[model samples]
Target: MELFSDDFTDGNALAGPLREIFAVDMTTATGRCAGCGDEGPVAGMKVYAHAPGLVARCPSCQQVLMRLVRGPSSAWLDLRGTMSLRIPMPAE
Candidate 1:
């Protein structure tokens, strides 16, 4: 059960690891919210780092957008909460 209402932070908390996953800056990446269909940058999401894993939630409807769990051997990623993530490719 959740006991604290102030346990949430901004998406800057996940910037490091998320950057490694996508190999790019996620702040510029657009994410489509599955809950309310809101489309915006991932950096706009609300992040909860109080748990073992980091959860990114939509700022519009407070819906989860992403969940990341780092383990000794591997890392787990859950993007089911987001309908789509648009990553921009650099020009060659």
Candidate 2:
């Protein structure tokens, strides 16, 4: 139930803004779901971009993990639904 059966897409749609905020490829990052406690890479989550903002939902429990609302002045990002976001460090 976490993933949508119809039009859910990958997190690649959020790569641009994620890079600008985290300075790294965040779509490949891992996020722990706050609802079902499931942990997985962001790329596996279901993304919906047709709304006023982009919404990413957990693939395990269908809980909203993140939302990105782009405004004319500044973009508003909400990640309260995500338990934690783990960004991989570059290998030396």
User: How many steric overlaps are in each model, in order?
Assistant: 0, 1
TM-score of each: 0.87, 0.87
lDDT of 2 by residue, 1-92 (tens): 46355676888888987776677899888999989999999888889987889999997777999999888788888999999999898898
Give lDDT per model, in order. 0.86, 0.87
Model 1: how far residue 45 lies from native, Å: 0.5
Clashes of 2: 1
Measured with C-alpha atoms, the lDDT of residue 17 in candidate 2 is 70
- Model 1 gets an lDDT of 0.86
For candidate 1, the TM-score is 0.87
Question: Which stretches of candidate 1 lie above 4 Å from their native place?
Answer: 1-4
